[model samples]
Target: MDNLTLVIALAAVAVAGILFFINRRPARQTAVETVSHRRYAGAHREQARPAADADPQTRFVETSKPKQYRLLNSSEQELYHRLCEAMPNMRVFTQVGVSQLALARGRQEAMRLSRMAGRGVDFVVCDADFSIVAAIELAWPTTGQEIDNAEDVKRVALQSLGIPMIVFRPNKLPDADTISREIADAILRRNRLEAERS
Candidate 1:
């Protein structure tokens, strides 16, 4: 081969070898990235495949049912309105999940919290800055022991987080003034208890 042609052939081979090594080299990934890649890879492969025709029986049937308008019952609605009026300075939220108020520390605590997380309080009272002041449950005459146990668990969970839970009988819901006073009293008591503990 001529000198120039021989040099050109060597250069082409060298370029090919460089490209081969670059393609073969594994990209560096962090522990989190590695796990994420594995998960994503599996999902991507499954998604790439064509989906099977869904069975008619298994498919969802269309319904004429209308969307629900009112979230709370009549008595609950009355209390919700009263709370809004009473706590004008503070924000009042209805049907708040237990998990929103407190956080779990460890795996075991997270498991414990999972049960209570699904359970929600009737109302949550928050300060101007949105810090949780207390949880409120309207006392309704309940039949089942299971419900009572669940409420007890919810109460204990809130209490552990230094949140006071106020129960009010639906028939005897206090006036706005009484509600304001009671909330303030509950907050003071909770602060005092925490102070004593610390």
Candidate 2:
């Protein structure tokens, strides 16, 4: 066959192969991305633990001490407000602790917030996502000798880094002055410890 005929035949075969592959791919057969219900706290939480009973969270009750104020909401009472703040950012991360990423994120943020407790033992408000919020408030004495050790551990590594750190959670806070104080204190301590070690 002449070179022109050979070239034309090869082109035809190539075109046929392309068409065959395209036809084989059915658009309807495409994979569907399913959003898991695990993303919601009320639904997934009950299934996760029948005994823990987030019903206790029904009341946004406060456990006050001379040193700290912690609000408890196991039922996700605080979720509506907190979750809205996360939109376009980490909004999809509702019902923290249900997912590993949420837990990790909360711990990291809490580290910087640990500082404010010393300046003023105001309430440390965290949504139900951070169970520690309850512990910090109810567990500690509000007035005397109260130290936030949880935030301390979060910065154990920073003990040698001396990085100036700060924790800031945007959007509505249960109480601004108190929460900011906690965040600042935590960050300052982390910075101080790191400076001392370094």
Candidate 3:
């Protein structure tokens, strides 16, 4: 072959080889990328799938229903009835919430009152004008530090508001007349204290 022709042939072969290499490399890279994408998608689907043995019917969902009982127990019921009977003129509310009886004037007081929200007096005696006259708690024979502390807090709060609190022992089971007398006396004493203060 002639020298120029040989040189041309070699250059053509080199260009063809270069093009082949470039095209082949991209095809391999594309295959590798496709495989990686499929693997990632599969892993994601696996993670999202629920357990093989999981049952839809067995899934736990929280639910609630209305309470089906009186607020006071049998002993409390008896006392509540007696209080109601004794105070025919006064409005006697059973299981009176502390929040309903007292209001918080500040953030700290609100938080404190919130803690005492669940704790309440057995009966709340209100006058004809619907103003709270006193809060009565029926005390059992049981004694505990927590109970004593709660009672003390309640007593102080009621006293500060010029509302009297009368504690009666369930075991003693005082008569209706005695109960009425005690309530009357408390109301009179509270009135006298306010009169003196003013």
Candidate 4:
């Protein structure tokens, strides 16, 4: 091959290597939730294991508490933070990447989390309400199914996976004020329940 052709081939290989690392890295620890009950049991044990700061902060908003768990645009985080604080003693972890399924060594991360849900996790938190609001205001489409169908899809997904989904919405969202409060409250509830000593 010519020098330019050789350079292009090297670049292609480098790009491929990077993609593989990203997809396969972290060694799929999160995906272990899909494989065995034992694995999920282990994960629950592990997930519940205290971080250095896992004391009073571990108390989560109960799952019954209303909250939407949708992902938000950057501009909305501050408002959401305030709303989260508005709840009595809520500490929220908002860093979840939509594409990042906590798993280990498998293509079936969703399945792992599905099983994990059965083990202990009662709710899946995604702030889908804003996405819905954004869809309505900007007329963008995020769901593969129609909104009603999409709602069913979401409900069914969690049911089959054995978890309730709490989609937290932005409090300052100009549209859909009613739904946003509902979703936020649901999420806040779950955040409180996770580490509560029964």
How many clashes does the backbone of model 3 have?
0
Distance (Å) between predicted and true CA of 169, model 2?
18
Q: Under the 3 Å rule for N, CA and C atoms, how many clashes does model 4 have? A: 44
The digit string of per-residue lDDT tens for model 4 on 72-178 reads: 65545554544354433333344332223223213465654453342221122334332111111111334555664654454444333222354333333433455
Off by over 4 Å in 3: 1-68, 104-115, 193-198
Poorly placed runs, candidate 4 (over 4 Å)? 1-75, 95-109, 112-148, 166-198
Clash-forming residue pairs, model 3: none
Give residue 174's error in model 3 in angstroms: 1.2
TM-score for each prediction? 0.57, 0.23, 0.57, 0.27
Worst 10 residues of 2 by lDDT: 131-140
lDDT of 1 at 55: 77
Q: What is the lDDT of candidate 3?
A: 0.79
Lowest lDDT 10-mer window, candidate 4?
A: 130-139
Ranking of all candidate structures by their TM-score, best first: 1, 3, 4, 2
Error of 1 at 128 (Å): 0.5
Candidate 2: RMSD to truth: 15.4
- Please write out the lDDT profile of model 1 over residues 1-198, one tens digit for every residue: 699999999999999999987776645335668989999988986775544786756755445685678878777888888888888888988988777665533465556677676778899888899777888999776889998887788888877666788888898888888888889987896787567546
Give a tens-digit lDDT track for model 2, residues 50-70: 354557666444345444443
lDDT of 1 at 50: 49
- Kindly give the number of clashing pairs for every candidate: 0, 19, 0, 44
